[model samples]
Structure formats: C-alpha cells, structure tokens
Target: MFTTVKELTEQSVKSGLPLSEIMIRSEMDTTQKSRDEIYHRMEKNLEVMEKAVDRGIHEQVRSHSGLTGGDARRLQTYLKSGRSLSGDTLLQAVSMAMATNEVNAAMGIICATPTAGSAGVVPGTLFGLRKRMQPTHDQMVRFLFTAGAFGFIVANNASIAGAAGGCQAEVGSATGMAAAATVELAGGSPEQSADAMAIALGNMLGLVCDPVAGLVEVPCVKRNAIGASTAIVAADIALAGIKSKIPCDEVIDAMYQVGRLMPAALRETAMGGLADTRTGRELKQRIFGGRAQNPAVEEK
Candidate 1:
C-alpha cells in the first residue's frame, strides 16, 4: 500500500523535501508505510530488475543460448564500450530473445525483481527506458511509483498469478505496469498513464498460461519480451493523447472476466496451447526425459 502520486507530491511540498528525496525516503521506510508502500515496493523491484539485467546480459555471453546472443552481446558491448544501447536495440533484444527461445527471458529478468516466473518484463521495460530517456534516479522512482499504482489496481481488482488468471495476468499485468511507467516518464498525465495500462491489458487479455511441460519455458519467456514491447507501444500511444474508450479499471475488470472464461487446461497446467501438442511432448521428453508425464493424460 502506497500513497498516490498526488498525495506524495503534496506531502513533499509541505515537508520542503525534494519530491525525489521524499520518494527515496518513503521507499527506504517500508515498514507500516501508508498506501505509498506500493511505490517503495516498485522501486525495490526496479532495483532488482537492474541487477537482473546485469545477470541476463552476462548470462547471454556465458551461455551463448539467448536469442541472437552475438548480436545482443555486440550491442551490449557497444554500450560498455561507451556507446549507449538505444531503445530500438532494447526492443530488438526482447524480440530476438522471444524469437530465439519462447521461454520468457525478460520475465526471468522481472522475476529477479517481482516474481521469479515473471521476471523479464520489468527489466525489458527499464532497458527500453534507459535507452529512450536517461531519467534521473528520482524521475525513475516517480515513474515506478506510477507503475506500482497500476499494478496495485490490477492486483486488487483481478489477479497476477498465471494459475489464477492465466498468462494474461502475469505478462499482461507486467505490460500494463510497464506501459503506465513509460507514460509517466514520457510526461503523460495520470489519465494517460491509466489509458496506456488499459490498452496494454486489453490487447493481451485471455492469453493462456501454457508453459511447456510445466516449465516456465516456451511461450512464457518470449511472452515477457513481447509484453514489454507491447507496454512501450501502448505507453507511446497513450502519451500521444489517444484515449482508450474503456477506462483502466474497466480493462482490469475485463481481464478478470476473461480469466474466468479461460479453461483449466490453459491456466498453467500445460494441458493446452503449445504445451499439449505432440511436438511439445517430444520437446519435453528431449529436455526433461521420461519422467515427464502429461498431467491431462495422467488425470484421465
């Protein structure tokens, strides 16, 4: 629970503290904090995401398994070599990762911060942000605060767990959060932030959680990158002042409704979507061996 941006900003003005300092202090003091706890938590999560990006970038070089590792590494190397990675490169990294392996690397990045299963989205978003705009730590914190509010709204109204609300809940929620953050960083108002979130969620509604062989591989990994990209696009559109006909709250409600309509097979059970096919089973056997059993078949 965290105070709204309006409240936090007003309080900062009253206390004669810079808005950024107030945000940082509030983040550091997480115990028994007011509704503003969400802001603190999101900042904490973003810190985690930054660490994860370091790890992910290193992992790409070490394992040589990530999508277009050489290309991404080249871009990363250029950044380390004194050239900054652009937003386009960040977006390409996500797309390449998704195209290379469906496992959600960006979600893996986010899980390093938010949830292990949904790690990639936040980092992907942050990477894009760093590329597009070099905001100060305080600006980043404010952006995160706005994003956290959207995440809180989604959690309060719908669900973020894949099992509970499908992949849409996990990746979709991340996208909405990222989108809102992007909007704020791009100087959009709260209403625009909300609209970006709504658009992101609306586009990803009802996406099934169908990790192959019950692993957060396959579609999960790729989905995270895709989710990140979608969030950016959504935010950019909203920042341009394009309003979504549906409000953010209503979009969250729609997500919940769609989640309810999803079949159990599509809700992280690996019984449907790409997980249930013969190819998926073969891939599972190749990766996990004979111990893997199709839960659907076992139940029957």
Candidate 2:
C-alpha cells in the first residue's frame, strides 16, 4: 500500500527487505496470488524482454512508417568498432533501449514495463548491466520487481499515460524506475535507490509527448534510448553517495503539475513540438496522403 517513494523506501529500510521483496509481498496481499505465480509471471515478462532485445539488435526491424529501424543494430555495430566515445555500458544501454522500443514499433512482441512507448528503459538498463555484472536469472527477475516498485509509486501518485501527463510521464517515469532498480541491483541502499529515481526523473521534467503522425515511432524510440542512458548515469550518481536535493516524491508531484500545465498540443496530439515541424508535417502528409493534407484540428 505504498503510494509514495518515501513510504516505499522507508519500508524497505525498516523491514530489511529489498525493494523487490516488499513489492512482491504487497502484490501478494493485494491480489491474493501465490508468490510463485507472481514471480513466474514477471519471469515470463523478462523472457519477452530478452527476446525483443535480441531480435531488434540482430534484425532490421522497421516500423510501417519507415521512420525508425535498424538504429539499434547500427549502434551495436558502432559498439563493435571500438571507437565509441561513451563507455560500453552506456552505449549498450542506449542500444538495447532503442532495440526494445524499435521492436514495439515493428509490431513485435514486447513487455510494456509501464507502457509500450517506454518499454525499453527497464529492460535496457537491466540487460546493459548484465554485460558487466553477470546477474543470475533470479537476480534479473528481481531487478524487474524493484523497477515495478518505483513504477507503482509513480503510476499511483502521478501518471504513466502520455496523453494524460506527456512524455515525461512515460519515458521520464520509466527512467526513474530503471535508475532505482539499478541502484538496488548494484547493492545500494533503498534510500539511494530513491535518490537515483529522483535524479533520473528530475532530469527529464516537462518532456513533451509529440510523436510525429501520432505514432510511437521516431522520437519515442530515440527518447527511450536517451532515457536508458540517463537511468544508468543517475544510478551511478546515487551509488556514489550523491543525493537529490529535491526528494523523489516531490519530483513526481512536480512532474504531475507540469503535465497539467502542458497544452494539449504538446500532450501526444502531434500538433506541436517535433510533430509540427515542417519535416514532421511533410512526413505525415506523405504517410497518410490527402487525409493529412488538412491542417491538424485545433483544440477547442
């Protein structure tokens, strides 16, 4: 019944239980499902995430609009070149994040961690860490539970829908959840996990949901990549003992308020931001033909 980051972290610390355990216990109480059932379901989700990441990186997955495809493979090839400016972990996270979202765009099976648009971040960070940490299968599944814990707080206290709270709610919350889970997986304290979430989410405040052509291609895929990188960095900062001056719950509240102030055009309407750019509009007309020749409907 934890509805805020403060409550979630405090319980984790007091009970001497990992954040993931607390979430599993909470799920048991609420759903009355046996522990094995809940765990097995999450494990299935992990399997789906693994397959999506593998498929996207190994294949040239393209959306129907032809806007985003093969970028994840492209990034992976670059990683193999040994000339990347960023470290392998960061680049791998970015590539994997792009991979998951690209799969979603291509209509491939994907586990939507919070939503399909932001699905990449959680598995991205986890698989990225897998490259360096070598977590066991159980640890990998527990990583998801930890991420779900933070996501639960965000979804209950704020929003996870793009139309309701913009891209900040989608990608932003996903990034925070990934960061917190990364912290726990790295042996950081529950308090540090909360700090990681605050830092990650605060970094993405007010990000708009202006998907071109009202589709989850284009910026959405790239945004998940960036969110994954942000999550990794945020987790590192928290593990280094840095704290967010603004608490995790307050950051979430700020996100909600900012979303409320955002105009409808910026809230997934495809009538503003990159969606309204000349190139964006041109692509829209090309994709939808005469139907998109008309101007976007104004919000009354």
Candidate 3:
C-alpha cells in the first residue's frame, strides 16, 4: 500500500522541502523516473496530443467524415474564449467525440487530461477549483500530484480503459482522481483525500459503456463532464470530514468486481445498450461504411 499524503507531507516538512515537491518526488520514484524526466514526458505527451488534434481536424475535413464537428470546435472555442467552458460543454464534447472516429479526437482530448473522452470531467473539476480558489502554482501542482497518485492506484488496482473495465473505468476513475485532487486542494487531510476518492468511485461504480457507436463521440464525452462535476461534489462532501464505512481499497476492489461482471457487449464495442439501437447502426453506417459500400471506409 502507498503511504498517505499526511505521512509524506510530514516527511517533506522534516526534510525542509515543500509538500508539492515531495509529492512530485514520490511520483517520480514510483514511475522509476527522475522528476525532470517525468515532467518532460508529461509535457511531450501534451504536445503530441495537441498535434494529433490538429491533424485529426484536417483529416476529418478532407475525408468528409460525418463525425461530430461540434466537439473539436467546442473545445477550441472554450479554450479561446478566455472564460472556461462550462462542465456541460466539456461533457458534451467528450461524449460526442467518443461516438465518432473523426480524427481520434476523443483520444486526443483524453490526453489533455480533461476527462479522457471522459476527459472533461477531471479537467473541468480542476478548472472549477482554479476559478473558485485561485490557488498558487505550488498548490495547483500539489493538488494534481495528489490526483495523479489516486489515478495510479486506480490504474494498478482497477482499470481506466472503457474497453477493459466499462464506463466505470473511464468515468469512475476520472471521478476518483478529481475527488482526491479536490480534497487536497481544499486543505483536507490525506485520509480525507482517500475518502473522497472512495466516495467518487463508489458512486460511479458499474456505469456501463453505452456509446451510440463504436466511435468515442456521443455519450462518452458528455458523461465525462457529468462525472467530473460529480467528482467535485463528492470531494466537497469528503472534505467535510464525514467518513464512510468502506475504505478506499475496498471500494476500488468492488469497482473491479463490478467491471468484471459487466457484459462484453457493453464494454465500448458498440454492441449493446445505445450502440445497438437502429439509430446507432444507421449512424455508424452513415459515418463509416456499409456492407454494400466497399466495407473499407478508412477512419480519419
């Protein structure tokens, strides 16, 4: 098991380093990379994602793809407006992106750490915290570190991929990450951070991946935003010092169990739920190709 943030913070204090620095150091150690290397890797990942989105948009236009145009445009608008996009916008963008293969926008957005197609939820929650609290750089970094820690735990113990663990992995993991980050930002103890994570994960457990198509557009994007908002709410409640009967570890285990019990058709394969409907099949045929139309419609 990982050490609590409180223990780590105390060690940092004893060592005369900032809490954020200590947290970063801990993460670096866990990943077997130096702090500079980790930072550089994250920066490079972000840059790559940005380039992918740009190329994806161009490809979509060139291919005359029927993918949702609103998502990329909305994200661009939100970034350009100088005012943060509402959580709703973020959610809608992610869900829409998931339902289409248009330039892999959903994957790109997830790379942005917004919600993960599911991307908007985590970033939206962080953005909300930034607007509401205006914390210093160190504070923001610490909060992100705390969030990352929880994410690592989830990745290790449960899952984060919709294909592997259903929507619970994507949305539930984002919610847990955001909840822990929120608690840390709000000056809650390490235990509180864990509690927040538990609450978020518990609430989102067993969420099915019901994308309207094999694409990452429709409900995936919007659901991310909703998950992000809920993470914030869960964190707020945890920060109030209310403890749950179940521990964070137990909640994570429960999520894993639930995910395993989910049907294969509901795991983002577009075979069940919303993805199996007549409308969904028609949409897929229109966007991709069909049995009659050369079956090889290349995805942009």
How do all models score by TM-score?
Answer: 0.74, 0.96, 0.73
Model 3 C-alpha lDDT per residue in residues 6-66, reported as the tens digit of each score: 3543564577654445667876676787887776665564344334444443443222335
Comparing 2 and 3 by lDDT, which wins? 2
lDDT of 1 by residue, 104-192 (tens): 33334333323455666756775656755887776776766555556665776788888988988988888888887777677776667
Off by over 4 Å in 1: 1-31, 34-44, 61-114, 292-300
TM-score ranking from best to worst?
2, 1, 3
Deviation in Å, model 1, residue 202 alpha carbon: 0.4
Candidate 2 has an lDDT of 0.94
Give lDDT tens digits, candidate 2, residues 1-300: 688888888898999999999999999999999999999999999999999999999998998888888999999999999999988999999999999999999889999989999999999999988979899998899999999999998898899999999999999999999999999999999999999999999999999999998889969999999999999999999999999999999999999999999999999999999999999999898888765434786434
TM-score: the better of candidates 1 and 3? 1
- Cα deviation of 177, candidate 2, in Å: 0.2
Q: Say which candidate scores most in lDDT.
A: 2
Q: What local lDDT does model 3 show for residue 216?
A: 69
